[model samples]
Target chain A: MNSRLKFLLLNLFLLCSLSAMAQEKINIGEKQAISSAILNEKREIWIHLPKTYNDSSISPAKYPVIYLLDGEINFEYYTGMSDFLARPPYADMPECIVVGIKNTERTRDLTPTKSQKKSPVNPNVILFGDSGESENFVRFIQEELKPFISKNYRTQDYSILVGHSFGGLFAVNVLLTHPEYFNAYVANDPSLWWDNKVLISKTKSYLEKNKTFPAHKFLYVSQANNEEQNKNWNSEMTQAIEEFKGIVEKNGSLNYKHHFFESEVHGTVSYPGNYDALKFIFKGFRTDIKKLSKNPQLLEEEYKRFSEKAGSNFTPSETYLNVVLKFMKSNDFKESEDYFINLKNSLYPKIK
Target chain B: MNSRLKFLLLNLFLLCSLSAMAQEKINIGEKQAISSAILNEKREIWIHLPKTYNDSSISPAKYPVIYLLDGEINFEYYTGMSDFLARPPYADMPECIVVGIKNTERTRDLTPTKSQKKSPVNPNVILFGDSGESENFVRFIQEELKPFISKNYRTQDYSILVGHSFGGLFAVNVLLTHPEYFNAYVANDPSLWWDNKVLISKTKSYLEKNKTFPAHKFLYVSQANNEEQNKNWNSEMTQAIEEFKGIVEKNGSLNYKHHFFESEVHGTVSYPGNYDALKFIFKGFRTDIKKLSKNPQLLEEEYKRFSEKAGSNFTPSETYLNVVLKFMKSNDFKESEDYFINLKNSLYPKIK
Candidate 1:
C-alpha cells in the first residue's frame, strides 16, 4: 500500500481503538425487582461490585453492604468513592457491595407519612399526599433485598443504610424501627417535618421505650443555615431532631453522632458526608500496626496475598500510601504509623 | 378502550415526555478550529461562553480568559468552579471565558524535546527521548490559539494559562520565552525534569541573562510522594526553580509563588491546587469593603445584574453563599460580609 493510504488506515484503526477503550461502559449494577406493599409497586434495583469481585478462585467472602437511596442521583458518587476508598492505602475501609435502590415513585416510596399537599404545578394530580412507605421500604431491605443479596453475593451481616431527603427520612425510620437491620445509618438532611413531624415524634417515643438496643452507629447531619427559620419545615424539623439527639445522649440507648455542615446545602452535603461517615465508621477496622511494623515484610506480604487472592495485578501506588497516611493522621490512629511508614518504604524504597 | 389499555397508553406517553426532557442537552460551548504552523497541525478547540452570550441586551463586555489544558480531564471542574466563583458574595473573580484545548497525541504535543533512547521491548520505538517540541507548542499558543480565542470570544487581554504534566511544561515554556503571552501562568506539578532537566537548565540560563522581565504571576506546585522516582524529580526541580525564583524576586520583575503539598499526590492535587491558584492569581483584583458597606444596594444590584445578564437563573442558593463565605474566611477577604448579608437578604427576604 502507498504511504497516504497506509496513514489513513492507521488513523482509522487508532481512532477505533481509542474510542472503544474510552467508551468502555462503567459497571452499573445488575437489574433486580423490589416490591413494596405500601407503594404497591415493583421497582428496579442496581447493585455495583468492587473491581476485585470477578475472582472465581478465591472462596466467597462475605462483604459489608451499603444500601443507597435515590440511586439515580447518588449511585455514581458511591461507585467512585467505593472504588477509590477500597484501593491500597485507603484500604482502611473494606471492599463492600453497593446496592443502589432506584426510585420508581420517589415521593411515594420515600415519604414516611401521608399528607394532603398538591404540588403547585399539578394540583389535580396528587404530588405530596402519599407517605409512610418507609416501614415497608425498610422491610423490603431487611426481608426481601438483604436475603437475596446474602444468598447471591458474598455479603457479610454488617450493612450500612444510606439516604438523603425523603430517603434520609426512610433511613432514620429504619434506624428507629429496625435497629438490627443495619450496622450503620447515614441520614443527610432528612425531611423530618413530613406529616407534621410524625417521624420526629416517633423517634422520641422509640428512644423513650427502647433502652439498651443493639450496638450500632448512626450519623445525622444538617446544613448550617437550615435551623434559622422556626416556621421553615427544615428549620423546625432539624431543631426537633437536635433536641431528640440531646435527649438520646442524655438518657437513650442508641449510640448516635451528629455533624452540622455550615458550608454544604442539603443536596451537596452527601458527597463529603458519605466520605467522612465511611472513614468514621471503619476507623477501627484496619490492619494491626504492630503486625505491619515489626516485620516490614508483612505489609508487602499482605499486599501480595490480597493481590494474588483477588487475581488483581494490583501493586500499591504512591497515591495509595499518601491516602493511607492522611487517613491515619486525621483519625489520630498513631498505632498505624509504623504500618504506613513501612508501606511507604516498601512502595518507594528507591526515593532515598 | 378499556381502563387498563387507557392507563397503559397514558403511562407510555408520560414516559416518552420525561425521556425527552431528560435528553435535553445544555448548549455548553462552540466548537472551532485553530491553525498552527509550529505543530504543523490544526487543532479543534472548544470555547465555552458565559450564559449572556446570546442576549443582545447585555453590553460588549470583555472577560478574562482561562486557558485550560488537559481539558477533557477537568472540563467539569472548571465549569463548576467558574459558575460558582462568579456568583454572589465571591464576585471578586470576574466571569471569564474558558478555552479548553483538547489533546491530540498528548505525549507528542506536550513534550519539550525529542529523545533518541529506544524502548526495551522494541528497539525501533523510542521511549523518553522526545524533546524540543515545547517551542512549537508555545508558538501554537502564542501565535495561533490566543489570537483565535481573542478574535472569537469576548475576552480581555489578561489571560491565565493552566496545565498539568507536559501541558504544564508548555505553560512554563510560554511564560519563559514570551512572557507577554499570558498575564498569569499556573503549572500544576509540571514535568520540570523533562529531557533530563532541559527546562531547568534553560530557565537558569534565561533568568541569569534577563534582569528585568514583564510583571507576571507564576504559580508552581509539586505533588508529594506521587511516584517513587517522582519524589526525587519533584524535589530536585523545585529546588532549582526556587533558586530561580529567588533571583527573580531580587530583580523585582517577576511575582512568583511556590506551594509544596506533602499530603496530596499528583492525580488528586488538581482539585485543591486549582482552587488555591485561582484565589492567589486573583487576589486584590476587585474587592472593596468600604464601597460595599456604604452602598448595600450595590450588592443587590450586582446580584441582579449577574442573574439577569448570565441567563443562569442564579439567585444565590444557600449552598453557593456558604461556599463564598468559606472561601472568604480562608482567604482573609472578609471585607464583603455586609454585601453578602445584603445579597442574602435580597435573595431570601422571608428568612430574616
Candidate 2:
C-alpha cells in the first residue's frame, strides 16, 4: 500500500505487459490497397504471410500464394483453412501466403461473359446490375495486383486461384483461358448457369477444341445439392452444374475433379468444400501413414522431393519428426537419423 | 513539381495513411497467463473474441466459448477456424469466443491415471515422460481459469472442450467425470490406450453406471487408422480405439458420435476432425435452404429459438436478409419483410 511497494508492483506489471505483448494475439494477417490502372481505382487486399516469412532466425523461405476472390467475407475462411492445413500435425498442404482480393464491384469484376438478354422473371434490382468487365479485373490482378504482391511480399511461382459462386466462375474462366496464371484452381459451386448457361456450353466446346491441358494444372470443382436443399433454388443453375460436371468428367486430358457435396446446401458448402479442395489439390505432399509408414527408411528420399515441390527449405517439423521417432527406431530409419543428426550439428555445433 | 502540387500530394498521402490505419492488420486475439495454485505453476492461455465482442455501437452480444487444449501451436488453427465458421456466407456456427490453454507440463497434466507398468516399448525420452495428474489440471481449469475468462469477457453458458492426442484423453476423462462443466466435448483421436487402456475400460464402466445423461450435452469422438496406415504401427493402440468405438456404439443413452476417419492417419486427423466436430456439436444452428426457402415466413420464429440456443441477440445478418430478398418477392415473405423493415428503421432511423 506504501508508495515504494506500489512502484515495485507497477514496474512488475509493466514488465509482464511487455513480455506478453508479443503473444497478445496471433498476428493472422495484414490489409493493404493497390492503386490499379486497369480498374481505374484502388483495390483492397488482405495478405496472410506464412509463419516462415520475415523471420531472420529461421532459414529463408518463399511460399505459394492463393489469390482468393470475395476477399472481404471469404478471405478469413482461406486464412483459417490454409493456416490449419499447413500447420503442425496435419501439415498436409505447404505453408503459403494468402492474398484475399476484396470486391469493389462484385457483378462487374466477377462476371466473365456478361449476358445481354433480359431476365425472364424480372430479377430483383439488387440481383441484376452491370454486365461484364471481368477482363479488366483479370488484367488488374495479373498486371497490377500480382506484381504489387510479388514485389512487396515473400511469394513463390506455384500460385492458386480460389473463388465461390460468381467468383468461382471467374476462377474457372481463368483456368480455361489464362492457364499459366495459376497452378491450381478451386471453384466451389460455380455459377455455371450464368448468362443462360453460356459458361457451361462454352466450357464444353472449349474442352472439345483443346485436347491436352498443360501438365500439373489442377482444377477442383465442388457442387452442392441445390434442388434438394433449397426449394426456390435456381433450376437453370442446378441443371447447368450437372451438365458441366458431366462435361468435365468426360474430358480425359484435363486433371480435374468434380465433387458432389450432398450434405451441404447452396450457401453452406463453401466452408467444408474449400477445406476439402485444398487437401485434394495438394495431395501426396504430406507424410501419409498408409504410403510411407510401412517403409520408414524411404522418408529421407521422399522428404527431399517434398522439399523440392514445396519450393521452401522444407524439413519435417519437430513435432512430426518426434511422432515418427516415438514409434520407429533409429536402426530402422538410418537415413532419417543421419539427417536429423547433421541438422542438429548445424543448429548447435559442439565447441571446438 | 510546383509548390502547390507538392503540398497537395503530401496532404493526399496523409489522408490515405490515416484512412488505412484502421485496416492495418486483423486483430485476431489476445493472450494471458493463468497463475495456477493447484499445479504450482503459471500456465499460458490465449483468448480470441468474436467480431461483435466489444463494439458498443452495433449490439450487445454474449458468445459461446471453446476451451482448447495444446494452445501454443493450435491457437492459430482455432483462431483461423473459429473466425471463418462464425463469419458470412457460412455462419453455420455463432460468433463464439475461443480460449486456448497452453501447457507448462504436458505429460504431467494430460494423462488420467498413472501407469503401473512401463511403456509397452522403451519410449523415446524426448517423446515420453511422467504423466497422470489430469485431475489437478482439470481443477485448475474449472476453478482458476474458467472464472478468469468469465470475469474478463462476455461469455455464454454454452461452452465446448476440445483436445487432440493425450490432450484428447484428458477431454474424455473430464467428460465422463465432470459432465456439468461443458455443453459439448470433442476428443480428436483420443489416446485411449493410455495407462494400459485404463481410460477406455473406465469409460465402459462409466457408461454402464450412467443410464441417462443431461439432455443438452453432446460428445463427438474421432478415430484414425493407425495399424492400417502404418504396417509397423502398434497393434495395442489400434485395437484399443476399435474397442472404444464399439463401447460408444452399444451405449444408447449417451448422445455421441464415433466417427472413423479412414482417409487420415494418426497424426493428420486433428485438422479435419476438429472442423467436423464443431459442425457436429452445433447441429441445426444455421438456416437451411429447404426449410426456409419455401415458407420464408418461418424465418422469424425459427431464428428466435436459434438466437436463444446460440445465447446471443441474433437477428438475420444484413447479407443473409439481402440474399433472401433477391429471390422472393416482398409480398411472399411478410414476416421476414416486417422484421427487416423494423430492423432497417432501427439501424437507420432518418428514412422519412
The segments of candidate 1 whose C-alpha lies over 4 angstroms from its true place after superposition are A1-39, A52-64, A89-97, A115-127, A148-158, A193-213, A216-231, A244-257, A284-352, B1-352
Listed per model, the TM-scores of chain A against the true chain A are: 0.70, 0.80
**Candidate 2 backbone collisions, by pair:** none
Error of 1 at B282 (Å): 13
lDDT of 1 by residue, A142-212 (tens): 77888888888877667888887787778877777777677778877777767777776787687667655
Best TM-score among the predictions, by candidate number: 2
Q: For residues B36-130, could you state the per-residue lDDT of candidate 1 as single tens digits?
A: 77787888676766544554543345677888888755554565455444543434356678888888767777777785445433466566554
Worst 10 residues of 1 chain A by lDDT: A19-28
lDDT by residue for model 2 (B1-352), tens: 5565555556555554644564487767777877899889988888888766776554455677899998876777676677677664446777778899988888889998775444323343233456788999999989999999999888777788999888888888998889888888888888887777997878777866876655567788888866443333346667677787777767665668878877776676777788888888766667653345455546667778765554444566544555555434443555555555565455435434
Compared with the true structure, all predictions reach lDDT values of 0.62, 0.72
